[model samples]
Target: MGHWWDRNIIEPGKLPLLLALAAFVLTFLITRVVTRLIRAGKGPFGNVTAGSVHIHHVVPGVVLTVIGGFGAVASGRHGFGPALSAVIFGIGTGLVLDEFALILHLDDVYWSEAGRKSVEMVVLTAALVGLLLAGFVPFGVNDLSEDELQNRAGAVVSIGVNFLFALIALSKGKARTAVFGVIIPVVALIGSLRLARPGSLWARRFYRRRPRARARAVLRAYHHDRRWAGPRRAFGDWLGGKPDPPHPLERD
Candidate 1:
């Protein structure tokens, strides 16, 4: 285990990245716990307010992100300075992404259904970073043989094909698949072969003339959402607290 860590992480100068990932996940978890406590009114933690306005954590997050980003760039990849800067950047990222929904809608909706997007984004970011730390290279270039890498044409062709698959998956509204596909070409290939989502650009452009294909796509979407939505929501709620009850007008 120690040898693997040294070879895969230390030798590759990935310690800062690992530190950043750890810090990001830890900061998010801590922020969630504090916010949940405030929501329940069970702790001394309270919202930061100034006069008539409430100060969101994203403010400080932006500040830290700027500082850490520049600091990391200046510190270089080796030594403790880079690692510390990485941690700071990670913390800033956590705070910023926690309020992502609020930024998107320009309103306070922390406990509303819209706020769930923040949790989803956080999870996605963490997953991608984790994959990177686990040695998955973006654009599927890591799978190339040494000889193929030396052949510039072969490398370019491989990358181009993989990128096409990712693009197709994105057009089909398979965002997660597209994202992971950048690191693993097979994932993108699978996504490209799947039916497009009903509301996606691919469906509108390609499935428009094919009524049967459209119907099948819609049906697949419905069943897929029905099967996974509940578990996905449950996991989100477990991590970020359940959303507030809907308003009466919304229910109506």
Candidate 2:
């Protein structure tokens, strides 16, 4: 185990990344537990406020993030300082992403349906970081042979091709595929070659003139949503807690 760790993590200078990932996941889980307890009115935890203005955790998160980010930059990739900075940055990231929906909408929507965006962002972030921890270099460069990488032209072409495929996947609304394709080109290639989702940028621009293609896209999207929406919602609720139901006054 120690030999494997040395070869995979220590030798690669990823100890700080490992610490950060651990801290980030733990912070997020702890924050959710405390918040859920508060919502149930079963804990000592409560919202922080100053007079009439509520102070969100994101405030501290921003401060810590700045300090830790700078500290990491100054300290480089080794020693206790870098490790501590990574932990701080990860904690701050966890807190900030916990309220991502609030930041995005510039409103207190943490308990609303819109709040699910936070969960999705956090999950995506964790997955990407996990992939990095697993030694997946971005843009499929890790898969290139040493000889190919040594050739500047070949390397550029490989990276450019993979990135273009990822962009195409994104335009087709395959966000997850596009993101993961940075590490696995085949994923993006598959997504880029598939039918675009309904209402996606690709669909809007290209499918406008093709009724059959539009119809197929819509049908595929409907089936995809129908098959996955329930499980997705359930997963989000399990991790982030179910969103508060709409009040009668807000209901149509």
Candidate 3:
């Protein structure tokens, strides 16, 4: 055991770690971008951003999964095993959170959106719990070949997450948006492993498809609001009874 662990499993490679770190940084930036794009205003980007509250939150989870997966793979552990499993865990966990959040009415403070999110969250959360426990638990790192476990876990988690996301997206879709989002992630998640490429490649491409116009704008707004605190910001902060910074456009 020690011989194999030392011989085939542990290798000195900074490439994977570098790659994972890059993915993490990219994920945070990309998430901010997506959030901004959605929140910029009521054009295509703004609408997408608002609607994305339903899907966009998964971006961080997906990013983390890829980082973990690639790190495992780069460590000279096994075929694309750890990375893939991590992806599954990521997507699955994201989905579970989304669904549960919605059902629990944690989607927002507003009553209407919260109601909708609560119901959706309940149904999806139940489904996710059942699927994950039954399918993904056995495919741990210590058990199967690295790639096999990763593939299995990735597939299970992605499917579970996408299933929930797809349900919401499709049911309330605008010209099949859900289908497009699901396809992009699915193809990228599965295909990247085969090429021994990191999943962040897909995430980067996904966000890159449209420049983060809204995100950039929102960031600008956020900064502006921070510099010049005003009446509206004060009122809003008071109303919310929370010392949160004002949104840029919300300032005045």
Candidate 4:
């Protein structure tokens, strides 16, 4: 009873969950505000990205990371003991989400150079590995208890979900976006499948969206490719072998 009270008093897990949800909502609100602010401040034609890095990427990411990290700590420490392990693991998970957001924002603003993209892949892979190893470290500080382990696993799952969301958002256009977009979601789907173990709540939720997401992907592909109405036309005859369709939905 005392332990329960202590856990509730010191760091209630529900608080973290509520905080995480609030952060998500706030981020969305901020996005809308920033969009309007940009339109008003930059003028209709002013470059939103011209010569300056916007806080949109950094601010929301920082807020989200904090929310996620706190939630992880709260959940893991529910029973008792220090939640440091949960916090550490949670932070790693938060980092992954932030990284995903950063990538999405970066892609939206500027195409990554091949070399830079490669470096990104390497760095992320390293970070994940390091985080996993940290969980297993046997420092004098409390080794991760069972709840902490579960929280760490949950954090990993959370990151995967965030990655999927990023993929869906980024792959939301025709042709050029389609080319890269198709590959990413498929990979994400595979990851989601692997994460979806029996009785895992996160896995269940992730799987639920798979079909709709796939449908969206198909529509995006068709929308982008439909612009190339005809086949094998000479290059100079029209842009990219065909004129842009009046609209992607207009069928022959």
Regions more than 4 Å wrong, model 1: none
Candidate 4 backbone collisions, by pair: 174-224
Whole-model lDDT values for every prediction: 0.94, 0.93, 0.41, 0.39
Residue-level lDDT of model 4, residues 1-252, one tens digit each, is 878655653443443333333343344344434444454575353333536864334444455456656655555545532244343333343333433534655543211222123223323443434433333221111233567557877545544554554344333322222222223444334433332322234434454568765555456546645765333233312211122334445454
Rank candidates by TM-score, best first.
2, 1, 4, 3
Residue 32 of candidate 3: its Cα lDDT? 35
lDDT of model 4 at position 225: 51
Where is model 1 poorest over a 10-residue stretch in terms of lDDT?
75-84
lDDT of 2 by residue, 164-224 (tens): 9999999999999999899889999999999999989999999999999999999999999
Residue ranges of candidate 3 with Cα displaced over 4 Å: 1-11, 42-53, 59-252
lDDT of 3 at 80: 62
Candidate 2 has an lDDT of 0.93
TM-score of every model versus the real structure: 0.97, 0.97, 0.26, 0.27
lDDT of 3 by residue, 141-227 (tens): 233466755697765664566555544434332212343334434422333222111123333444345456435534654675577
